[model samples]
Target: MACSNLGHTGVTYTGKEDLRETLYELCQSPTITSPTGGDNVAGYIDGTEFKFYKSDNLARPAVVNALLGKAKSNYATVYTNRADALWIKHYPKMKVKLMDQLKPTEGDGAVGVTLALQTVKKWPRQIAAIALKAPIPGGGLHAAAAGLSKDLDLPPGSRKKGLARALRYYMLATYSLVDISSAEAYEGLKNYVGALLVSDQGQILAAGINTGSFRHAEVSMLLSYFRNNPTATKVPENSVIFSTLTPCKGCTGFLSVTKSSNCVIYFGQEDTGKDGKVGKKISTQLSEKTKAPVGRSKEKLPGEIVPDDTEDTEGTGVVAMGTASEIHKVQVDKGLTSCMGTGSIATQIGKAKHAKEVLRSGSEALIHKMLRTRATDAESEVKHAVLTHIGQWLGTSRSVE
Candidate 1:
């Protein structure tokens, strides 16, 4: 479904395990001789003279593959086995120069490099600036549209430029599927401050897609945000599986992941205004929209704040434990009638599905096919569709609030 258009470059998954191994070796090497050097240096590694190129040249693709899957081979009918081969081939000439540009900085002049630090300083401020500078809360959609517009460096009069600005605010506001309080307040601040200005006509859809593509560019923008929080590498038993669609610039599809099952930390979006006015509202949007019988029941259980008793075998830990039962409950809550129904149904497309046919016969193919098709729709629809499909699978009616 046009993964590239959706900002899914597919390069992120190209033999990630192998690429990781190579990166590990590079890290151990003496290539990173100086954190603040512009000169090229060479040393022998395993008796071979090795040239130290840029750190990103060696690391960026690996990181990309870790997030996305693998890329398809363009020059050949057969798929490429090595992900690094592409970088080694087309990118070899550019690596040295790109690395030089990304080299460690000596002072405040470091500017574009050290993105993690740059993002830390910039993101919060950006949020505040939007909030404080605008004319109205939710009315300052243009400010959001313009700010993201600048971030993307979108060309003047380009469709993507307008979309970027709108999406920035839209994401913040829509984070709560059921409510728009925080987002509306942030938008309102921008309008109230008279700091926000927009010349572009309504072109948010195009801008959103472009912003989604920037997900790769601004990878470091969210580093601090993600780093501070922990996520489960594997699915958790207490994990509540909720599916939703988030439109980042271009890519929007079903993101079925778990929020903390026990303690749902609903940190409102960061304050972007200059006055430090952060959270203005606490809406139960996520809880209400993704609410299922399972989540409700779990939330009903008393929070584990009681004093610890060593003899209590069925302690809070046990209650919070992620087990098959919990996962099953979540899956059921998603509206799947059976365990297999929870997965995408596209993979099983074009196969026989009738009363006489066994559900498992071509289920995998059918589900994958369905997922491929659904991934291409608008982000909002994709989200709603996933919820609807999940609900249907669980034998729930389509009229869910």
Candidate 2:
């Protein structure tokens, strides 16, 4: 859960409301000369400067303390106050370069530098790439394995690189959990895909099966989680997604919507002879449809997203990356919620029960503790709704189907 934005300097001061006063004086100061090499810079606050310097361990900077509810110490701690929350750590020192420094010229109290900080932690880095070659539509297990092996850029070896590596990485990283889509669940759906959203560290952000024949499992989890969770900030940011079957039109199209830039490993390989990898095909088509002049209006096209109204047939088509004009015909069933709403907990395992207790107690180690425990299975729409509700509460989505 590392944030990709950060090396930015921060503001420091004695207390709350003090930072503002300090900034006001700093801005109005004639000591810091206004920018020159121009004709006429007519304004009380024409330009400003921002400098990044190593922070002191003495006390929490006013800005930092206010943002992060930590002790009044700016010193970096090894742990975090909020569980499942990503925090920032500042770098020691670096050369400070003022890039296009400017300030507002409004009437009263218009001060402070228009600035942003860069991170020393270059995030969004690829940690691992897993390729799953499970049986999928239009391809069998053998076809997928061969295709995946041939398409993979790994050194020549067996077809288990992604799978084995993922498992081993999971074992090595103990702060992990594995969510499983139980075989006993979601019996009504047919020709639907299933996936386990695993991180290298055994954490399972989601275990989901497709809502029905048309909706992809990945799409189901993403939409449900993102829509329900009020703050869509916490998520599996940099981990790769490993799916048993090759991604189809529905699931592949969701990459952009989910903000999913991580490496995606699925079972199907391109025909190689002609069809190309499924990833490549989808990327090409999506690119063609989504291309537009930069800086153009940000208005979304008709089909760019699966409409919020799942009841409307118009929104039930393929949602390509940024483009969504072309409508693919699809069969719709009664909405997912109404279909799978009958489950009740049969026999709750102690550990899973305890995890729920921790959830109730509001422990920060929510997902980590839940992953280690086991739970009994019960199939009903009610059960599914309850699990989905818990997953959202934990900042993710979960469902039997």
Candidate 3:
């Protein structure tokens, strides 16, 4: 894995914590002084290092072109906290020209800068947009979680348990962001998985979702980890990874190659997809090879408690409470209904309908049908469950107004 090398004025930050703090500081800094006028800042990650450009405005095409002139690869990711309208108008043209310059055989090279525009004052509106797209009952819950990202404080002495619950919440929240209709149409809701990588101390290293054809959730998470860490060659030992679904064969291979953590926990079993069958067998093989504990939690309904004397089953990798001895009781919110199996009932129905549509009229018709009949109620309940669990772990109460 090629990690990004951080560089700003010849200063380099080593380690993941340092990189995160430096990035946060850079984002908050007001003294950099943009040459063109406002507090706007623009930078690009060119596979290797991040280069910041100071300008009164967002980086113009000329500036970006100049930066690309000396770049080894055509791919890069541009980050800017400038006016949104400007990027909205400029991004298409920039993408077109950049694509024209891309090499057909460009393997593992920066493809082109994908613009990540963040406006300081429009965060509320951004949150609102996410809420609007979310299921009705979950809109407020999503907004609340979005607002509380910076205020996450795990209770003392229960940090590990809190972190495990937090990872589950993170996984669910990420999964909720998937466009269910599109997923049902093309694949299935069950296939749209999410993954999280956390350090031994409970720091979230990275998160990834399986949205595209090529990038599995685990592989996507590792790629994100490398991008953020920049210096890390492998996942830290004793680190824990949580995934919404079992790791498929490709993801297992990638995890093995990356020397990912031994402890992997999944919420859902493998589904009936092309790569799904490879999950358990490949994971068992990997476990045998690495001599690590690869396990899945036994199926339990919401609020169900495991017996104190329950022990982890050998070789099968069955564990009651993942990476923890004691499990904290999560308080379920009022008026929320529980759905059995891996995900919500809406997801299960969506998956069944998708399969039916696939057999009857192919994916296009399935997509059309899913778009027509949206499963908002069940989806909202799922989101509420995630928010409730997260709030319980953080020693707080959360609910949608």
Candidate 2, residue 336: Cα displacement in angstroms equals 28
lDDT of 3 by residue, 214-298 (tens): 3456655665665445466577665556554557655665665464445444433334466556666433211111111111123
Expressed as tens digits, the lDDT of each residue in 1-401 for candidate 1 is 10011111232323223322221223222323244441122111111111121223221222222211211211111111123322223323222122222223332113211011001111211111111122122232233232432354545443333333233222222121111111222221211010111112211110000011123111221221222222322122221111112111111110112112231112112223321121112111122222212222222232232222223222112222222233324322122113224343211111212200111111211222224333232333333233323222212110111
lDDT of 2 at 25: 37
Query: What lDDT does the true structure give each of the candidates?
Result: 0.22, 0.27, 0.35
**In model 2, which regions exceed 4 Å deviation?**
1-164, 167-189, 227-229, 233-235, 268-401
- Give the TM-scores of the predictions, in the order they appear: 0.18, 0.26, 0.33
lDDT of 2: 0.27
Q: What TM-score does structure 1 among the candidates reach? A: 0.18
* lDDT per residue (tens digit) for residues 1-401 in model 2: 11111212353432233333322333333322333321110112112322111111111111222222211223222111111111112211211111123233442334453321222221111112223222112212222222343443433233233333222222111111112122222345333234444433333444444443223444444433443342563335543343323455445545444534543343211212221254454332111111111111233333233233333221122222222111110100011112223231111111122222111111112222233323232212212222222333334222132
Q: Where is model 1 more than 4 Å wrong at Cα?
A: 1-224, 227-401
Preferred candidate (lDDT higher): 2 or 3:
3
Task: Extract clashing residue pairs from model 3.
Answer: 36-56, 37-56, 75-110, 75-111, 75-112, 76-112, 76-113
Model 1 score (lDDT): 0.22
Candidate 3, residue 360: the lDDT equals 14
